[model samples]
Target: MASPALPGREPGAGPRVEDLVQEVKRLRAEVEQLRVESAQLQRAVASHAVVDQAIGVLVMTAKINPEDGFMVLREISQHTNTKLSLIAEQIIKHAQDAALPETILAELHAALARRR
Candidate 1:
């Protein structure tokens, strides 16, 4: 007797079991990749927000334009061997208290004073 066809497949025409397993593996890998990509995107957005807040503080406190504000933040980040986002996060945290740490304030002033 002829074997019955698998559900939704013609007799002898559907993917083999191994092929289905491989397809499931491929789909799982894709889902994992998407998860990693999503996490990276979320971190990037959070970092961008901190950086923007730092820029705003620079603009308000240093009387600098937004472009120069970002430049100053970048320069300070470079000088301190810190990530720009970290520097920005620190700035935002301190600014909420209406003061920055003395060293950071000094570095910020110097960075702003320098020509890019």
Candidate 2:
């Protein structure tokens, strides 16, 4: 396959070792960027999981809409002086374990919702 570089020339066609080193550095930068993006995606997924579970709990216990449930979580996080993502992770893990007690869920929801 032809690369965007010169047709006959290799990607790093230069004879100097510095060129090869530069290519390696460039590739390393790309790899690092990909790693950072992957980590961000993981955090996003975790946040979504927490929000989804909290919403479900709210809908079941408080008969609230999804928007209201999210707003409540945002509020609680703000009031508790904690990160929203952290709060979400706690809620998600508890819900996933299937051992979350009703009292705890209610308290957590209330705590998270008060921030906003």
Candidate 3:
């Protein structure tokens, strides 16, 4: 049996308006998801940079190699139950302001000593 075409659509015409609308909606959602992912990646990159800078500071101030510097930071983070990125930020701040909590300073000294 032959069927009649939709009201305004020809038998062989392209997709209906509803299908196009759904596709546009899907594309919009994908774009939003991509935007969120990009923001997360940007934050990760910035945090990584801060950690690297802190490692460099440790390398110079603690007179340790970069690898050892990272271990010292990890040790401090574990012992203090703090995030590694926050530890890194504090280290950088101390380098700039000559101010750091006594607990952190003690842990840093201990960690550096253990590496020697």
Candidate 4:
């Protein structure tokens, strides 16, 4: 079959300007998607660092290992219907300032006690 012809161009000449424009648009969209994914991955990395610090605090305070510390945080987060990262942040702040919500403290104590 004959290829579609552009105004002043032969049927099988190199790619048309429209094709180049479409490819550029597609690349731009892909780049935007990659940027969003990169930002999300960065945030995840930061959250992971915070959680690790919080786990260190728990390990020291409860005389438990890192694995047990993570379990304690997970238990409190699950019981409180909170995000693990948020729970970890609160724990880190409490370590620094000695201030924490009573509900969270109670759940934390219960979780630690169960582990013992």
The runs of at least 3 residues in candidate 1 whose Cα sits more than 4 Å from the true structure, single-residue gaps closed, are: 1-10, 98-103
- As a TM-score, model 1 comes out at 0.85
Q: For candidate 3, lDDT tens digit of each residue in 16-115?
A: 6789999999999999999999999999999999999999999998889999999999999999999999999999999998688888899999998898
- Write the candidate numbers in order of decreasing TM-score: 4, 1, 3, 2
lDDT of 1 at 84: 95
- Between candidates 1 and 3, the one scoring higher on lDDT is 3
RMSD to the hidden true structure, all candidates: 2.6, 8.0, 3.3, 3.8
List the candidate numbers ranked by lDDT, top first.
4, 3, 1, 2
TM-score on alpha carbons, each prediction: 0.85, 0.63, 0.85, 0.87
Which candidate achieves the best TM-score against the true structure?
4
lDDT of 4 by residue, 1-116 (tens): 88678879788787878999999999999999999999999999999998999999999988999999999999999999999999999999998987889999999999999998
Model 3, which residues run further than 4 Å from truth? 1-9
Indicate whether candidate 2 or candidate 3 has the larger TM-score: 3
- Worst 10-residue lDDT window for candidate 1 reads 96-105
Candidate 1 achieves a global lDDT of 0.87
lDDT of each: 0.87, 0.69, 0.92, 0.94
lDDT of 1 by residue, 42-107 (tens): 999999998999999888977889999999899888888889998898888878775766777788
